[model samples]
Structure formats: C-alpha cells, structure tokens
Target: MIELQMYINGEWKESSNHEKRPIVNPANGEVIAYAPEGTIKDAREAIDVARKTFDEGIWSDLPAVERASYLFKIAGKIEENQEELTRLETLDNGKTLREAGYDILDAAACFRYYAGLITKPDGQTYHVADPMQAMVVREPIGVCGLIVPWNYPLLMSVWKIAPALAAGNTIVFKPSEITPVTPKKLFEIMDEVGIPKGVANMVFGAGPVVGHEIAASSKVDMVSFTGGTKTGKHIMKMAADTMKKVSLELGGKSPNIIFADSDLETSVDYALFGIYSGAGQVCSAGSRILVEESVYDEFVNQFVERANEIKVGPGNDPDSEMGPLVSQQHLEKVLKYIEIGQQEGAKIAAGGNRIVSNGLETGYFVEPTVFVDVQQDMRIVQEEIFGPVVVIQKFKDEEEAIKLANDTDYGLAGAVFTNDGAKALRVIKKLRAGITWINAYHPTYNEAPWGGYKQSGIGRSLGTFGLEEFQEIKQININLQVEPIGWFANKNE
Candidate 1:
C-alpha cells in the first residue's frame, strides 16, 4: 500500500501526532493506501506557513503573467500524467474509469482556463466627472483555506486551486480524508512543477480537526468549501468569527423537468445520466425529476427499464457503466435513504437493493434506484440523497412543473427538455438555480459560472467569477486637479 504524508512548507512531513489512517478502495474494500491523520497543530503550522508566504510576498507579489505561467505549467504536467492520474482517481474515488478520465481532462482544462483568464485585462476604469479619475483593481486575498469534498476529489480541488493560485494567493487545502490518494498525487505534481515554498500546502485529516482549524484560523483571509449544506453552514459560522471571505458550493436536490414535447428517448437517456452518473454522488445531481403529467407514466416505465440495465461493478471493470459509492459509510447512507423512501410510502419503480452478485458482495455497490408517486413534501423528495437514488414526481402543466421543481431547499441546477424552444426558455428562466439547461443536464463549462441561487451555494466557481472569489477588489480614486479651494476661510477673509 502507498503511504502519503502532508505537504507543508515545500516538504512532505508526517503529522504532528505521527498517526496514519488507512485509505480504503471502496470497489473491493481494500486498504489501498495510508494517509497522515493530521492534527489541529499540523493544520495551524500549514496555515502559518501559507500566511508567512503570502505576507512575505513570495507568491502574491508575482506579476499576473508570471502566475499564469505557473498555472500553464501545472496544466501541462496534469495532462502529461493524465492516464496515471485517471487510474488513481478511479481507484480512490470508486468512479468508473471513463468518468475519472473526464475529471482528469477537466481538471487540466480548469488550470488552463484560469491561466488564460489571469493575464487578461481585468481591471475597470470609470469615466468619472471632471478632474477625478477612478478605477477598480483586484488583488489576492492573502492566504486561502480551501476545503473540497470527496466526490470529485481531483477536479474539485483543481476548481479551487487553479483559480486561487492564478489569482496569486497562497493556500492551505484540505481534501476529504476519505479520498486523499489522488489529491496527494496532485501535491506531488505541484512539488515537481516547483511551486514556490509554502505557496500551496495540503493537510490530511478529519474535517473536525483540520477543516475546523483552517476555517476558524485568523491568518486565513478566505475560505472556499464544497460539500454538504450542513458542513458549509458550520464553516460559515466558523469563518464569521474572523470575518473571513467565505465561498460555499453546497448540496443540491436539483430538478430535471421532462415535458411531453421533448424527444422521449433522449430525455429518458439523459434522465438516467443525470442521477446515475458518479453513482449520484454529484453535488448537482438531478435527484428530483419532474415529468409532465400526460407523459409521466410512459417516461417512468422507460426510465425504470433503462436504469435496471445499467451495469454496476467495480471502477476497474471496463463494462461497469456506474461504479460503487465512495465508501461503505456512504453506501449505507444511500441504502438508508432508499429505505426511508419506501417507509415514507413512495413506490419503488426500479432497482432499490444493493448489488451483491458477480463477486461484488464486498464492494460498496447499490443498484440505480428510482422512486415514484413521491410528494414534494416527502423527505426523499426534498433531502439530497447524494447517491443513485432519484424521486420522480408528476406535474399536470408547465406551471405545476415549475412549482414542483422549485419546491426544494436547493437551487443549484435544473434543466428543461422540450421541443418548444420558447416554452423551454420560459421554464428555464423560471428555475431558481444558478445553472440551467434548455435540453441538457450535467454538462458544465469552465467558461461559465457554476453555483446556485438559494441554499445550494453562496458564490460561483469555474469561470471569471471563480477567480474573483479569491480576489479582493479595491476602488482607486484620484484627483487630477490637485489645487485645493478654501471655501469657509476665504469667505470669512
């Protein structure tokens, strides 16, 4: 098994407690690696290193173009190691190899996207009245504390890392203790690329210790977190003490509305892809599907038929269309939600049990589950299962569809599929989500902003907005006419 250590101050070091935790492969329940179980002390040290690095202007003082150059190099390195990284991500995250490959490509592209964005003319000059000149420039927000979730380990880390580094901020990053392998590999790449000392530090441990320290620390100027809503709320409270800038991308019970006018086959296919991809571990998983009532029965039948056909197996299996959940704990959580749906009087229209055949008993595999006849008030309909468990609701008309779709606490993402372009536009516009698609689901671009309108998130990521999250804006006002006119004294004289 591979042994991983924390990256701090440009060196790989053991945790202050000298304790290591086993990193398990969810596919086969094997201990694939060991990661340092960092303590609050180690977290404080990493934060201090990042703070000193930023305060010393070692990285933050670099020219914007110079910072872009480093990001470009890092992107090149990621592409160079794409295959290996993909394999490790699959092994660590328990996602299909194909999905992991996509993440690797996207991670590289994210770095390149930010690299190009940083060199562009970002400051704005205002046309002020007469002898006054005004402009706004963006600067790095000192040391950043970045916490990423376990689902998209490498890509999510890159989503925060690339932009933060591109904006010239040193960071103390914390990847989920559950899936630390690929992120550890990423830190190795940073070391090889010669990232300046203390510019980017990584700590590995439970969220309560390392994550808490990072969010609550006074030295960290900003905290960017992507995880469950509960944890995001906790981080907000923690950052509130120091008044640190906080950006959160939290949970979503996003909706995918399929109308009768849409291509039935394509809508069914995408509906399956929406929730089943990544085993529905995605934060923006379209777990809530609202169907036009006229076509609801037919769509439900076809969806169940296809969802049953999905090949569930280990990530290494080439034929596996969907892999296991990230861990046994998560598997249990998904199964528990499935049980809750049944207990809440929702009918199971598709697979709802664990996959134990074909020598997959040891792996954390659950069948793609679908529940029908679910009410908007049901817990399964409202809560984010974060697994391959979806609830399909029926709505009578366009108005009802929109109402059902927006009935959740989350407003992260939504989509409408219909042949009527005008109707699609109208419905999509009404979605209270940050990301909406007319006839698509789960396709996101690095060039566009990604976040939610409500509790789904507080700030956007992955575009120009993503870079600005780590930056502080300053307005500069200058008086071109320097001569001062005395109003009161001259009048008295």
Candidate 2:
C-alpha cells in the first residue's frame, strides 16, 4: 500500500500524470511498494533543479570542507537508521540482512573516506623557473547523473554520491527500479538531515525512460554507471551524443587462480564465497575458478561440498547465507547460463538445477551451482552469468593459469593463491586485472582504489583515486609583478 514518489528539489512530488509501477519483493513475488513510473518530464525537472542548485546554491559553491560536512551528516543519518536501512535493502533487493549490514558499513566507510578527501588539492607541482606564474587550481564539474545497479544499490549510491558531492557537484541519482526503496529512504534521510534543496534528487522508472534522459541530458556534465556490459555500451552511446564524461564499472567474469603450492582447503573455501556471495551477482565475483591441474580434483571436490552446505532463505532471516535473485527474469537468466554450461560440455559438479526448498517454493531461488572441467572458450566461462554459478577450469602451470585468467575481455578482478610468495608475486605481475588478490579473494578496502583495467570499467571508485575523478583542473598563471608588458619588460618573465 506504500506509494513512492520522485524526490526533486527536496520535495516529494507525484509523477506528472500519476502513472506508477509495482515494485515486487523478489523473495515472494508480491508487490511490496508502488514506485513512480518516472518519465522524461521528471528527469528534466530533476536536472533543472540540479542545474539551478549547482549554479546558485551554497552546496555547489561552498568550500570542499563545508560540502564534506553535509556528506558527513548524511553518513551519520545512515548510521542512526542502520537497522531500518538494512531491512529496506533486504526486502527490496533480496540480499540477506547480514549482507545489508555489510553494505551499510561499506557505505559508511565510503562516506568517511570521501569526507576526508574534500580538502585535498587536486594536483600539486614542484615549481620550475616560472617565478611570475603560480600553479594548478582545482574546479568542480556541474551536475552529475549517477545510475546505480540493483545488486548493491546503497553501496553504489555512496560510491557515486560521496565523491561527486565532495567535489561540489549536484547529483540526480537513478537507482535501479528493482531496488528503489533504499534510495527513497536516502531522500528522506537527506531532507531530514538538512541537505539543501535541489542539491540531490532521485527518480524511479525503467532504464529506457529515466536512464536515457539522464544520459542525454544537456545539463548533466557526467554520467557514473555500474551495470552489465551490454547495457553499459548502450549508455555509452547515449551519453556520447553529448560527449559527456562517463564512468562505468561494467560486468566481470573474473578468475580465481588456485595453484598447487597454495593451501588448497582454505583457498577453495574463499573461492566458494567469492563466487557465490550475493548469489554471484557482484561485478567482481570470481565466477571463473582456474585451479592448477596438480590439485584440481581435490580443490573443486571440497568447493562443491562446502557450497552445498550454504543455507538459502528469506533475506530478513538472521541465519540465511543466501537469498533469492532480484527477480524471476534474473533467475531465468542464471538458469539458462547453467543450461548453456551443461550444453557446452562443462560438467555439473553439484546443484546445477534449482531446488524449491522447504516453505519457500514461491520465491525466485536458485540453488548454489558449480561447474567442473570448463574450457576457457565456453560461453559460461567467458560471459558473466551473474548468479551463484561457478565455472571451474584446470590449468597445467603458472603460465597457463595466468593465461587462462587473462583470456577474457574482462579485467575487473582476479586472485592468485599460493604459499610461495615469490611465485605469487611473479604471477601477480603478469595477470592483467585492476584488483589482484594474493592468497585471498574479495579483499576490497575503502582506502585502496578499485576499477577494472580493461572492459570491466572506466574509472577508479575509492580513496584518492576516486576523489580526483569528479574534479577538473585549471592552471593559473599569476602575475606576481604587475608590470605592463612594455618594450622594457622581460618577455620571459
């Protein structure tokens, strides 16, 4: 019975014509909330607010320290309502409450990290002989359009909002329609915590409408996106019409390379969680496991056994290790990928088929799946399945392992496990990936920069690397001596 409206200029405004869409809980396929079927008119209004706020308001003109204080306020509000936010995220997105708890913590860390960078000078210079000329100056881009993916809505929101706001740009966020509830909560939080009107706005609808408008908007100076590769390409084309600055963290078919010199039992356990966490919906999920031939059988055997033990239930349940997919469509997509794996000659180790477990037959749930003896060229190996499906391949040696890991178009993330630090280092330098973990998986830190080196993404998303993305540089040549350039004036000076 809850009705959601677009948040524009700090007002909860109804859709222009009251057209609405039903947002269903993927867990039970029941309509949980009614979201606005937002349109071009809504996006335009949001952009107009952003433009006015950016050009005239204190939010866009204030010093970075002041802007960061506002962000800190938002972060504090998020903490105060952490339990409620976690429930909303789990109900809307079908991640376990445990996962939502982790996401809130991550969001808090991202906000704190960006808050600290607010006063960082963009670029510094060791001055040369130009005595009359000063150095570089930092400038903020105007308004930004941030499109967050469904898998990690709140976390991605923090990633986009923190840096852009820290750089003094207004934002219009378009969270995925499937996971719109948390953003609505964020809107409420922003207003409650005294964020200036028009500094932050949000809309809800399918991507073609609201998403297209943001990408093609004249006032939107940049588009930051995280989603699938194919859709990202379309977004790129749409944003290219205006040649807007674009940042994308696209899909990944990242590899987990487990060598014989490593701790097989522990490595395989981490690899299982790496691929199957969040139902393998992470952009950096280790979907492709490349095990050294020396211990391939032993490693995958234990991996499958441990994966079979994971418990799937309602995300709100305190002990559920996994939950349903975001929707039935995504479930079918993952199932089809599992079918393709079987057809492409990959062996199904265990749980390749869906299981309607006790008291949860109505939800869109897929069992934890593991594939064995997968080839490098298989569709299941190359393409991002984006579910709790693992495609395990066996490699002969270190060179072959690195070769298999880097074979895909994706270079988002990969891991190498080895007790031999020397060998791990040697292989690490050869793997083509943005984030490479040694002897572990999914070791992301708020302080370390994260992005893909290849088709996986376009920009970094954390620490100092993330802060600089929203800023543009303007070099200033100051005339220390105000002497007119007369005939006697030194030309060099």
Q: Return the lDDT, model 1, position 135.
A: 94
- lDDT string, candidate 2, 137-163, tens digits: 677788999999999989988898889
> What are the Cα lDDT values of the candidates?
0.93, 0.87
lDDT at 158 for candidate 2? Answer: 86
Judging by TM-score against the true structure, name the best candidate: 1
Using lDDT as the measure, the top candidate is 1
User: Model 1, residue 377: what's the lDDT?
Assistant: 85
**RMSD of each predicted structure:** 1.2, 2.3
For candidate 1, lDDT tens digit of each residue in 382-461? Answer: 99999999999988899999998998889999999999999999999999999988778899999999899788989999
Instruction: Quote each prediction's TM-score.
Output: 0.98, 0.96
